[model samples]
Target: MKHGVTVALLVVAAMAGTMASARAQGGRIEERALPYTPLPADIQALDEVIKAPLTDDFVAKSFTAPDGRIVPYRLLTPATATVQLAQARLPLVIVLHGSGSIGQNNVSQMTAFAKAWALPALRQRFPAYVVAPQVDVRSADYAPGGDGLLASHPGASLPAILALVDDLLGRLPVDPARVYVVGFSMGASAALDALVAQPGRFAAAVAFSAVPPDRDRAVAVAGTPTMQVHGDQDTENPFDPDHAWAEAVAAAGGAPIFVRYQGMEHRVPPDMILAPGWREWLFAQRLKSAAPFPNP
Candidate 1:
């Protein structure tokens, strides 16, 4: 009888130890292996799933402009996007990538900002529409504007982008008043283009590592809520001119929220995007405003 009691106690202690080990390794998820029962069909399915790109996260797609230009893009639909759309139209978040993410393949820009939006926790917290488009143009395509501004006929893709938006709205659901656009580097210039070219279209915009457009276009989108983020020590794009441009926009009644990352270079910082109030602040901007505020 004592031997039996000792054996039962040992079994219970072993399970307790196993439970404690799991609790201790909660944050170190990488040490865990893929659990499998080793059934034939299960093993084959796992192999196939592991080999394929994460389709549930984002999918490669293309759009053709009215002028016959083929613009390749990647679309990311949050798992709850459809459900959220049903209850209330979700906002559209357009993400544009920098020069390094430029390519004809349409996959570079997808990965640049896709991970941030596709994060499981972020997706659950804020489900919305996200579009990342890839452009093939390079340095030569950009035309120099007066003092610290680069210009491009970004209107070229406006048609295709609108078409995609319309298609999404028809099939899914969208909050027309909450449309927002965000971009980085070269993409920032494009965001300015969209803002200027299509005023009253976007509720708010976020630009990173970008200078303003020409002096004339800078004030064209006045009253539009905008957030401009730049690095003060940016060697490639420089900072003095963009800082002045942001000041000029503020003076022109745009009143853009400017965030210059001190001592940082020309790159997007994780803290700026993932910080606590960032998501709420970005989604809370509205187009109708009598008194606009600008932060320096």
Candidate 2:
């Protein structure tokens, strides 16, 4: 068998046992089960390149929401020389971290997935502002329905997170039409919450292992471009509900790209981050209208 496939099979085999154990102990399966079989060497290298020490260009900042909540976040801007020469407003990408990285340290939220946007080559090619916001607790809420669908709502922290985005848009030369949001696990749920809470605000969104937004709100985000990436074998956030959510979106007249990884668990797929397709797709999107903020 090919090495990658072999490794994937091993991962799936291990997860089956791990999930069984967790269920037996009545424990919640979270990110503590990470470091899933080391990824391919090329992917490993790419991951390292992005998550390496933040260069001097990455700045740490905080935002105070209207509700008086303080949101700590790290912002990455393109090289000063690049920003100055750009004639058009730049895109803004909000990177939300999963629950495992939740904290007030202002640094834990800079997960490898969040840092992918700061890659030197990607930054030079895309040339956008990237912000990774950190919260001290769960940043979103998820309720499972008896009908087997999962409903997602913005947690107390998400309003502040979006507020921070607004604050950045006001002061920075951000192209509202190109605003995008990406997140994983818990953050993934928050990304959908952002979409549901304010429908016309984001240009596009990319969510990984996200619990689908409530079926009722599916129509709200139908117009926005969204891509959901999930593992078929995910136990933390079951795969079936996310799949159902995509179907709901399609039924609501939306075309959402749902990428399924077979035999994988609740972990970020290396391909999603290492490949260039996501970046290409992300940069190609713009809001239908050029409104600078969410429609009130």
Task: Give each model a TM-score.
Answer: 0.71, 0.83
Candidate 1 — which residues are off by over 4 angstroms?
A: 1-56, 81-86, 138-144, 147-159, 166-171, 289-296
Leading candidate by lDDT = 2
What is the per-residue lDDT of model 2 for residues 136-183, given as tens digits with 9 covering 90 to 100?
778788886545577777888998998888888888888988899999
Best by TM-score: 2
**Candidate 2 displacement at residue 277 in angstroms:** 0.8
Q: Write the per-residue lDDT of candidate 1 for residues 73-119, one digit (tens) a residue.
A: 77777675446456756777888777787677877665424556765
Candidate 2 has an lDDT of 0.74
Supply candidate 1's per-residue lDDT for 56. 48
